[model samples]
Target: MEKIPILRMGDFLLVTIQIDMHDQLALKLQDDLSNAIQQHASKGVLIDISTLEMVDSFIGRMVADISGMGRILGAQTILVGMQPAVAITLVELGLSLPGVATALNVERGMEILRRKIAADGTDERPG
Candidate 1:
């Protein structure tokens, strides 16, 4: 089975989805990310899906679920780099991806996460 790499950066977890997603891979990501957030006490999650040109209902739901799960585990989730068509397809499919915050790119996503962490007074990084 293939796996998506989740990198830990300070109080955040970054996930770049560089491959086509399947049911199993999505499930694994959800499980791995849940564990990682708890293990690292991460404050945020940034997921970049720029490489994916398309999305189905399952994938959309998975993304939404990941965001919701992160929130439940005390982490803010930001999705970034979504292609225009992919977004349209998701809306057309009626998968609005509720509760998931999005940004145009990784940089913007990271900024959003940073602001969120700072506002929450959870910035534990050393200066």
Candidate 2:
């Protein structure tokens, strides 16, 4: 089974989806990411999906579920690098992905996460 890689960057978890998403892969990603967030005590999650040209309803819902799960785990989730067509498909499929923040790229996504951490006034940086 192919798995997506989740990297830890400071107080955030970064996920870059480089391959096409299947049902099983998406499920695995959700489980793995949930574990990572708790283990790392992540404050935020940045998911980069720029490489994906399209997204089916299942993939779209999985993305939303990941974001919600992150929130439940006490981490903010930001989705970045979404293609225009993918966005359209998501809307067409009625997946608005409520409560999920989005960014144009990884750099901007990281910035949003930093701003969120600052706003929360609970910096997890090591002294």
Candidate 3:
């Protein structure tokens, strides 16, 4: 199984998650990404989950955890490319995320991150 990948696109780390119907990968993804986000603190993240058919309770919690952790690490985390069905389901599940912005697409998320980084005067590549 391929590990869930998070790609660095300009200032925002764009991630596209692929999960099977069985929902086996969510836990590992959370643990790995929690560590990865902590390691790359101060870098914004944009997650794309449009491909995901559904987001269960466990995965939703993990995502919410990442959002909070990203803030603590001085990074702005955003969710993009979420299908309407997934979005509605997440809302109904009472999944809550703190400090995580949602965008319609990767480009919008990246734009927001750019403005954020520019305002903070931080270079995307770091020193």
**Model 2: per-residue Cα lDDT over 8-83, one tens digit each:** 9989999999888878988999999999999999999999999988888888778889888998888999999999
- Candidate 3 stretches greater than 4 Å from native: 21-24, 38-42, 96-98, 122-127
Q: Write the per-residue lDDT of candidate 3 for residues 15-125, one digit (tens) a residue.
A: 688766345566667666667766655478777887888887877776787787777777788888878888788788887554568888878888888887787785556
Task: Give the distance in Å from residue 2's predicted Cα in candidate 1 to where it truly belongs.
Answer: 1.4
Task: In model 1, state the lDDT of residue 34.
Answer: 97
For each candidate, give its TM-score against the true structure: 0.92, 0.91, 0.78
**How well does candidate 1 score on lDDT at residue 53?**
89
lDDT of 2 at 72: 85
Question: In model 1, what is the error at residue 15, expressed in angstroms?
Answer: 0.6
Ranking by TM-score: 1, 2, 3
The digit string of per-residue lDDT tens for model 1 on 1-127 reads 6899999999999999988888899999999999999999999999999999888888887888989998889999999999999988888888887788999998999999888777777656643
Which candidate number would show the highest TM-score if scored against the true structure? Answer: 1
Q: Rank the candidate models, highest lDDT first.
A: 1, 2, 3
